[model samples]
Target: MPAVTADTLTLPRLPDLPQTATAWRPVREVVRAREFLEGEGFRVRRPFPGVGLANADPFLLLDHMGAVEYGPGEAKGAPWHPHRGFETVTYMIDGALEHRDSAGGGGLITDGGTQWMTAGSGVLHSELPPQDVVARGGLFHGVQLWVNLPRAEKWTPPRYQDIAARDTTLLSSGDGGALVRLVAGDVAGFRGPGATRTPITYLHATLSPGARLDLPWPEDFTAMVYVLAGRGTVGPERRPLDEGHLAVLGRGGALTAHAATPWDVLVLGGLPLNEPVARYGPFVMNTRAEIIQAIEDHQAGRLGRTQVPHVTAADEELS
Candidate 1:
């Protein structure tokens, strides 16, 4: 039998994103459970740390949340690290993070802000507590997601983007309560920041109880809806999703998300880059040699390092 593609497939349109069948797989699902820290002591929830659930091709590791209270000395952050052949996006919901990169990119991202780091070829960097913040008590609330890079761009130059809240486009329902911020694509007649790298749509949405939100997606893309702070039900399948969990919609177009209560959720979906993925020790690549080169560059002291930002008192208390 001949193979079928999106161009040859026809389907009815829905108010949501167009449906595209992908190589859908559970890969793995993980729950972050709070763990007690020794020493200065901080509450932390470790997610996808075990080898069993790092990241699948296309999708990578997802750290749902972190709070400074999770570590001692208000220093609740990952120190200098290396990554290549992938991208990392840090989304801040309620707190701030001192972001410093090896590609001459550094800044402090606060609430409603985002920092997108492209570790294309390679880079050495760290996400840590700001200098001014010190060891005082503070709130560190946010999520960091890793996205796999295409083989062609895996060894390209590394870069970073600090996406501010104001730069993002917002779409609201006619009733005026339900809304979403388009972070990196077009949706609801609104255009996002247009970040280059992946064909992606990152939407931050909120809905009131008994309200519904419909999205128009590309017919050739796979999508997953993640509930951050409420209950959500998708499709006729009636797949119920609650807070701190993820709902991956399979084989469909035009997603229907109904809120059981007032809730916050992030709708993220993108076309697969369609390339082999090989990852090792903060580096991702299509071939083993590429991953090795990334490590060699970091070890040879050829990678760049940016300055860390200063953290404010208010920033520390942003949990």
Candidate 2:
């Protein structure tokens, strides 16, 4: 494991404020996860970039994979591909995903694990189910989030952080009805393991019936929550949100969510890039010329090559 220093692990803290009554942000819009196909025929529910909702500032896309059971040999995950000018975050909920990249990095993101990859400049990679899981066939569930990079760091060298479930910072409510797993960024004083160029917080929370959670957040960040299971109420008005619904929050210093039933939600917030976003399939850049250059680079083998040609990068040992 790599040593984690304060500089690498902690995000800059916003100025502290006098203790005041928690004010919940209102729900700006409620969007449902829409089904889509991506990464070599894998099915997903994309809540953002759908009909009603567009890009959410620093967050470019989010794909919620199945809680469905896959029969033996039925799973087909993302195949070999290239990415640039952004980072890819994969959070595993119930199954295993094997990952390999052109830079000689590879690992397995099992249940409760997360793989954070910075496809700065460019990199070739693939994510797929391990053979054992494919043969035995079991529950498969996860989410993939794309975090856009600022122009200044868009061409930084690629890197990877494979975080095991045990590495995540877990916090529980006083009554024990709510639990939060902080994967990246700072929340309630706990910092996650992954380091990000963009200041952001990514968390997964579970709320038991009748439970309420009040989490402080940076006022300037764009915040949103996606309910993975059950129904819940969010914000000061306690707007009702059913399963598969995503709630985009308005400006506030805190977020409040109450569970009508047991609920699982993914919470994400980030400081906006406030720059132009130019995207061509798999490549996100600040300009169309940069997008064209990325494509040309991939075609010309400028992105590093993987050792295993037929199997993508999954079979290579992590460097």
lDDT of 2 by residue, 25-116 (tens): 89999999899988767789999886778879899999999887899988778888999999999999888899988766778888888888
TM-score per candidate: 0.77, 0.89
Tell me how far the alpha carbon of residue 129 in candidate 1 is from the true structure, in angstroms, after superposition: 2.7
Whole-model lDDT values for every prediction = 0.62, 0.82
Candidate 1: segments with Cα more than 4 A from true spot:
1-57, 67-72, 305-319
Model 1 lowest lDDT segment of ten? 1-10
CA lDDT of 74 in candidate 2? Answer: 82
Residue 139 accuracy (lDDT) in model 1: 60
lDDT (Cα, tens digit) per residue for candidate 1, span 1-319: 0001122113222233333442222212333333434223434433334344344335676566643443335556676777777888877776567887765466887777778887776677777657555555456666666777777777667776767766656666444446666667676556676375777777777777876677766656656676667786765445677776665555544566778888787777777777877778687788887767767888888665433233322342352
Q: Report the number of the highest-lDDT candidate.
A: 2
